[model samples]
Target: MADHAAARTTRSMTVPLVAFVAGAVVAVLLGVLGRVHDPTLSGTTDLGFRTVIEMKVVLATVIGALVVLQLLSALWLYGHLGRRPPSWLGTAHRVSGGLALLLTVFVGYSCLWALGLEVGTLPHGEPVPLRAVVHGVLGCAVFGAVVVKIVAVRARRAPGWFLPVAGGLLFTLLLVVVLTSAAWYVAARGWPGPAGY
Candidate 1:
């Protein structure tokens, strides 16, 4: 019984540790690549902005912070589950969750905005309707998910399951957002725009 309990504890810790390490590695690699290549954007405007790489850096930082906060909150919640923690732990969990949600929304918006501007919907070049539409839809979905999470947490009807379920969903969404954004970045760089400018 004791060994089983210990194993469960170890397994719980494994998820958070993996999240943290993965976030750190992605952040470092993206940051280094951004510095080395320093790609430019040129289309409707003859101006250059390292927009994609910058977006990656911003997303990485936000996601990294979110992962750390989520891990901390998870650990606290684990303790509370075993034996009720102090009032402050509960408050901390709420605060951390709120921040994570906020950051996730920001990442989503920034990604869509970057995509729109780069693809020429605004004033740059011929617009790629498909990419724009996909980005916009994903951004809205992320926002909607955050709203649902907020409502669930505040209701406090079934916190034990609610929190974990929400966290898992948000984590999955973050991964998708990261992967898609990375894919779009690569595609943008590979294909030349109006001026290649």
Candidate 2:
């Protein structure tokens, strides 16, 4: 009987073990993908201010806004807000989370397809600036962070604090991704006008 009980405990530990392994696999895959050269959008360039990059920036801004909502909704759900959460709060969190994920997929693909993965190197030209490198690194980190968060969600045996820590990490990585890319784009290019680069 004691042996059977010990076996059950061992099985339960597998949930977190699997989650950690999965997250590591995801991070490694992303790292490998970042090194592959995608020539699809190598020659593509828009002279207008409303370029694809500009659009990505706008989309990232929206995602950042949604993250704010995610945080608020999460706090409410967890009773950290010091007030009763509305019945719809949970639904709001789910919808926002889904939307954020979809938008992130779109933006991430757009970046990789349009600009491979380099910091100093141009999409097809010489090195432009250091911000590009920072942006590329942060973008990859975002993927890894997302994988970690998903693992935390699925790991039933994970500590109560793990979810929140994972959530915070995802949020921080996302914010850095936006700041390094979209925000930098806007700073270099005037609104609705093509960049002078």
Candidate 3:
């Protein structure tokens, strides 16, 4: 019985551990690639915005809201907040999560395709802004974390505690991403529509 229990425990950990390694490798490779590649500057088709940055900002903002909804819904679904989750709550959680992931991919692609990694000083020799550096690191980390979370979530036999932890990590990473990028842009530029539009 003890032997069986030990084997089960080991098996349970195998998937998550593999996932962690994969995530780490992906993050490193992406950062390396971003450093080597020259940005297109033209950006992945701006989707209808005047510029890629504008489109990226808008998509990121929407994804931020969806992420917020995902966190709340997950909490509610797990009975971490309030009463029992409604029947439709599961659907809402899944939909919001899917949408957030989808939009995140778009913003990430735009960043990589157009801007690449944030490094070096400006033309005037001013250092790259600290927020940009932070945002760039977190942006790379996001995809890795998301992969781990998704893998953990799908692993039915994994430890019960892993899903929540993975979700929370992803949540925190995304919140910082939004704050440093979209929120920072809006804060610095005083909202896109007010002046730009």
Candidate 4:
């Protein structure tokens, strides 16, 4: 019994560690590509509004924070799935969930700003309609899932599988939103340019 429990714990930790490493590697590659290609991409800047560099910095920071929080959430959830949840696991789960929610909200707001859809004018700027809407909706969905998780936690009735389910769903939604927005941006204004700019 002791050996089995140890094996389960190890397996749980391994899964999240693998996921975190994979996500980090992909994000690094994307950042490198963006840096290499952003300068050469025409119309990367939103004229008469925020500078491109500022926007890039803001987006990069938000995205990086979100990714890190997601990894942390995954790790917490993995621990929750172990044979015995740690004493502080519930608190850790709540913290990670809150952070994830905040990150999703920031991503939605930033996406709107980047697409020039906010309630302000950047001269000659037009919103990327479908892409912006999709991104915003997906972000909201993730936020909603987080809200549900919070409510469950508060009620002290959260199911054992709830955390993992919520995490997986949010991750999937984020991936779809990013990928689709990228495709739309590429189709509209060629590759390696500011996506949804």
- Using TM-score as the measure, the top candidate is 3
- Candidate 2 residue runs with Cα over 4 Å from true position: 1-17, 42-49, 119-128, 193-197
**lDDT tens per residue, model 2, 1-197:** 99998887777666556765676676666656766856365554443435777768888888989988998899989999999999988988989998998899788877777776775556588886677777777787777777878877777766566788779988988888888876776787745444664
Each model's Cα RMSD: 14.2, 4.2, 1.9, 14.6
Lowest summed lDDT across 10 adjacent residues in model 4 is found at: 114-123
Q: What is the lDDT of residue 166 in candidate 3?
A: 84
TM-score winner between 3 and 4, please give it. 3
| TM-score on alpha carbons, each prediction | 0.46, 0.79, 0.92, 0.42
lDDT of 1 at 85: 63
Pairs in steric clash, model 3? none
How far is 108's C-alpha from truth in model 3 (Å)?
0.2
List the candidate 4 regions with Cα displacement exceeding 4 Å.
1-61, 72-100, 110-133, 180-197
Q: What would the per-residue lDDT of candidate 1 be over residues 1-197, giving only the tens digit for each residue? A: 99998887666555444444554454444334333442334321212334445555455456656666676667666774466666787677667666766666555444434343233353456675765445444444455445444544554333255556656665555555554555565556553333334
lDDT tens readout by residue for model 3, 101-163: 988888887887787887777548999888888888889899999899999879998898888
Q: Give lDDT per model, in order.
A: 0.52, 0.76, 0.85, 0.49
Q: Model 2 compared with the native: what TM-score?
A: 0.79
Q: Please give the lDDT score for candidate 1.
A: 0.52
